[model samples]
Target chain A: MVNRCLITPARTLLTQTINPSLRNGFPAMTEARVLVLDADPLPRLDRLGARARVLHTDEKSLAERLPEADVLLVWDFTSDAVREAWPGPGGRPVWVHTASAGVDRLLFPELLESDAVLTNARGVFDQPIAEYVAGLVLAMAKDFRGSWELQRQHRWQHRETFKVHGSRAVVVGSGPIGRRIGLLLGAMGVRVDLVGRRERTGDPDFGRVHATGALPDLLPEASWVVCAAPLTPETHGMFDARAFALMRPEAHFINIGRGQHVVEDDVVEALQERRIAGAALDVFAQEPLQDSSRLWDAPNLMISPHMSGDTFGWRDDLAEQFLDNFDRWYAGEPLFNVVDKKLGYVPDH
Target chain B: MVNRCLITPARTLLTQTINPSLRNGFPAMTEARVLVLDADPLPRLDRLGARARVLHTDEKSLAERLPEADVLLVWDFTSDAVREAWPGPGGRPVWVHTASAGVDRLLFPELLESDAVLTNARGVFDQPIAEYVAGLVLAMAKDFRGSWELQRQHRWQHRETFKVHGSRAVVVGSGPIGRRIGLLLGAMGVRVDLVGRRERTGDPDFGRVHATGALPDLLPEASWVVCAAPLTPETHGMFDARAFALMRPEAHFINIGRGQHVVEDDVVEALQERRIAGAALDVFAQEPLQDSSRLWDAPNLMISPHMSGDTFGWRDDLAEQFLDNFDRWYAGEPLFNVVDKKLGYVPDH
Candidate 1:
């Protein structure tokens, strides 16, 4: 018999064994090994371990043991140890999966050049982001903060607020997050204009979707402008003083994308001048925004610690997604959500 | 020619006439008796005097001339004078339309009993209320106020947030405003449970609706419970201490309905106790909430000065609704949005 290997069907093994060569002619009783990196509780890996030989290690041990593994599941979202440590002396794992949507944290030149497949947690964040955008739009329109203040004082003041219907909105970025945001708003009767990288067909009820170049025209008409695009060279610092100036004096802005996409100083300036009505920001240019930043005092602005796409049970959704992908991989079927190293997505585009 | 009256339309009519009937019908007529509520510079109405009788009234003269008018278009919402002073002793005007919703300020028993027909601005407010609800949801979910404080201090903390999807919401009222709220949230993937007065078929999305009695069971499951119901004997103070106590600690309460529906002291107590997570109130038991009231200081509370449904150009939509009704009445067509006097709405039920 050919030295055939039958990888114990762990979630990770199932994901890696999708290659026809790996599945059909293997040493029949030999188990494939998987390395799970940087998981604290390691329940998901433990569950996989029941079916296969799973080795779990933190950053301290990963570099030493990575070469023996057939698959690697990168669970540590905060560290790029996988990129720096992967592609060992002989040959690397056939596949790698990240527990996050953005793999910029894990991208390495070597990983990009290698034939190893890459996948990410994609669909998990879409609805949450869309919901977050809706919430921001409502908070600004209804003056929720003001209401909370009144409740503290037992004061009831009747003030006029703006309505969403007949209002125009511009959702920047055409990714799943942005598209979902548009769908939610469009259903509310607000005329939504979705600005994507380029136009595509069969999109539902979008009032108008233009390229980034059309933002100048779209901005002036928008009562609410949402930023849900990714953080890329093209999107970094895309919202600045000029962008704010283009918006209506009554318009409100919301950012659920990467923080670096906005020029923080310009946002503060525009708000201080009362040029735009208000804004809700979930991401900042810097993490753990320094305590000394002046954005806190910017008038009409609502800030949230970046929590828009992070929700309860989110981890479970990511785990489930990985398991489904693993099943597809083991069956030699085309994998879903495979990331294109260059565009950084499976590129539904 | 039936009295042979000639009514000449004013040149400024294009700007002031929001009612389609007035725009299309009055302008084409060369001879019809017209009474313009001429106040101030009155040039717009003065031009009409050339071919028809124009009644110039200050605050004092309106009561005396009201009976002779064939129709009364209440453009001024500030005047409660019409409710108090209109002479219904003789045959009242054939029609009365207010350029506002909630005819509470204008409705009198005499007007109800007279041959005069009444219509109010209803549909104008539906979308605005819906938008307001969306804002409240977002503000609470995203911790917008907290974020704002952090932003003011230039502190960025990336925290996890509760998502609107897979969450349950209950909209207490089944009117256009409440239905619109349900629809908006539903679009965001929230499982919306609309509670109306009673169970009925053919209602929009009635599958999700429950009766008022089901509120106790629904409260515990709802992440958001919105109050858009009208104020009635049964509904007054419905959200009492017990109701608040029933809500989950993670739930948020929003009141866009009349303030009298909520027990202010009880709501404060609930928030203080953390029995329910938070609340956003736009309407209050008293208007211009007293500065000394303790509600302003309530923990996890959001207060808006009752401005949710009010928006720019909202008055125009209200005006158009009335004008459409006027045309229907003159043309012997059944009127739309006729008030149910007892129920305070046209009996869509």
Candidate 2:
């Protein structure tokens, strides 16, 4: 997800209530009703001011509001509330857009069958998530957590760490985010094998993009196995006990993708039994994982909340991207980052 | 250190005693006596067997053995025994080499004035240290420490972290190590300003290597300030309070160079005052940095036991490197990493 760092007047005008139609390029989107599924510290959609009748709703009110809206903005991408409160296929908005890259949460049977077009905030998160993955890889390889622990004890113990250079990594996602991760890791001297939905050759970035089925063969050879795949039926629970068994004892595992992509119990068991070197999870099966969960006690495991793609000023970037797409929608132009409801992600073309 | 992952026969023959002279391309040098300043688990110099009389000595026995040895291999590079036991200009080994990058420990006035040639393991540590520094930069930018802390408390907290890409780094030290660091960071999309003792232009890696005098101007703009400079009178205590004060509040300071380059107390004060965002020190003025040292409690300060360049198999690499240089010394070929004693480093060619 590589968002253009747009330098637009809306960045400054976000907090203000201004008639956006007077702006140079934006035409009024009159007669359209926009329904926002709200979260705390609501998004600055003032950029769409006086152009459409914007309505805000929570999980409780979303179903009733769905029938009247012309456009549905899933601002609270974390919620599965939309799925639970979704109106029937016939009453839904004409267009549905999620403020996130993954459309997994929104892919209910009704929504998938609905005529409403699906789009997502895809490009905004690519680079940030890639940087985060690289950081995790380095942290695990260098034993930074061990260093911090040693520092806490005021002990100066020297340990020989693993080198990131010349190491092999299998990145299980050939999307923009995974591609960026491969590029950054490659920059650090890592040999990256990117895995896509299907086998592809002569990729501009990765010379050979292996298919998902090739993971079993690739797992044993990699020093790192990263999960960045979209959460589709075929991808869900792809990294289970068998997958962990195939990995070398020295290899590390990292997941910045949807939690469903990994079997949490198997990873926890792998760490406890020392089957793998270590693991870093930025996403879990249940985000804000319950405090009583066994994951907190998993040995040699690093757990970070699902904030990999959210860097400082990320909200501003997301907002800008949404507005840009909104402008295209208003002009009767085809939108960017349209997710294929059946596929659960924008097909890599 | 960037030790070559050598696949020589010696790697397997290391533990066994063998007459190395029978090996291809190696000539016997029975006249030379080599003294190894030893540490626990002595280096496998079996490759030197029967060629030179090898003697292992510790700090107490070093001065007594100095007169008998023709060559001094400072295997225990951390020890200051050489400086304390040096027999002065009248009686000294013809050549001295440290199995480490910095020659600060061996740069005593007597040795500098003597005819003995000093060489260091220069190329070995360059790539490893660069990788370590890059790791530290990514770790700090992504707030890995904070994530670890939250994970420890079973807290699922999401925080926006800084992006490493598009950040500026001021790397002080235009040597191989610094150059490599700049290259790796540049690969991560960071703009690097490499500062050297003297200004240089059109450097094959870094186009314009700024002089040390430009540091103050560069400091305020950098998100990271890295010290990889060799320790010399001119560079000693260079990163003091003034340097920290000049840095942006968001900037992180990293020291992979000699501890003397930084005034420890000044850094302690800066960290305590929250003048800088964070810091990571792999070297301290007095290491195994005393248990009572205030650095341990310094907020956001990451401390390690001077192991930045020490990756797994580093010792073997160092041993092999020393033996490689030994081959040149025995052949009477000019040494590869001959240090300019007056400058206290291998001058950049």
**Candidate whose lDDT is highest:** 2
What are the models' TM-scores?
0.81, 0.92
Identify the runs in model 2 with alpha carbons over 4 angstroms from their true place. Answer: A1-29, B1-30
Q: Tell me how far the alpha carbon of residue B279 in candidate 1 is from the true structure, in angstroms, after superposition.
A: 2.2
lDDT of 1 by residue, A1-349 (tens): 0111122333344434433354444433335566778665453644443334777878878777787776677877656588667754455777787877767666678888876677777788888888778777767776666655555556555556666666789999776778788888877777888988776556665645688999998999999999988666678899999999999999998998877889999999999999999997777776656677777677887777767887877778777777776655544455666777776555653
Each model's lDDT comes to 0.71, 0.84
Give the per-residue Cα lDDT of candidate 2 at B220.
97
- Per-residue CA lDDT of candidate 2, range B1-349, in tens? 3222212222112111233453344445244678899986688888876767899899999999998776789998899999889985546777787999999999899898886777788888777888889889989988989988988899998999988889999999988899899999999999999999999898888889999999879999999999999999999999999999999889899999999999999998998888999999999899889999988998889999999999888899888988887776665455677888888888765
Worst 10-residue lDDT window, candidate 1 chain A: A1-10
* Residue-level error in angstroms, candidate 2, position B287: 0.9
The C-alpha RMSD in Å for every predicted model, in order, reads 7.1, 6.3
Residue A286's lDDT in candidate 2: 87
Q: How good is the docking of model 1, by CAPRI class?
A: medium
Error of 2 at B225 (Å): 0.6
- lDDT for residue B82 in candidate 1, whole number 0-100: 76
Per-residue lDDT tens digits for candidate 2, residues A271-299, read 98999989998898887888888988799
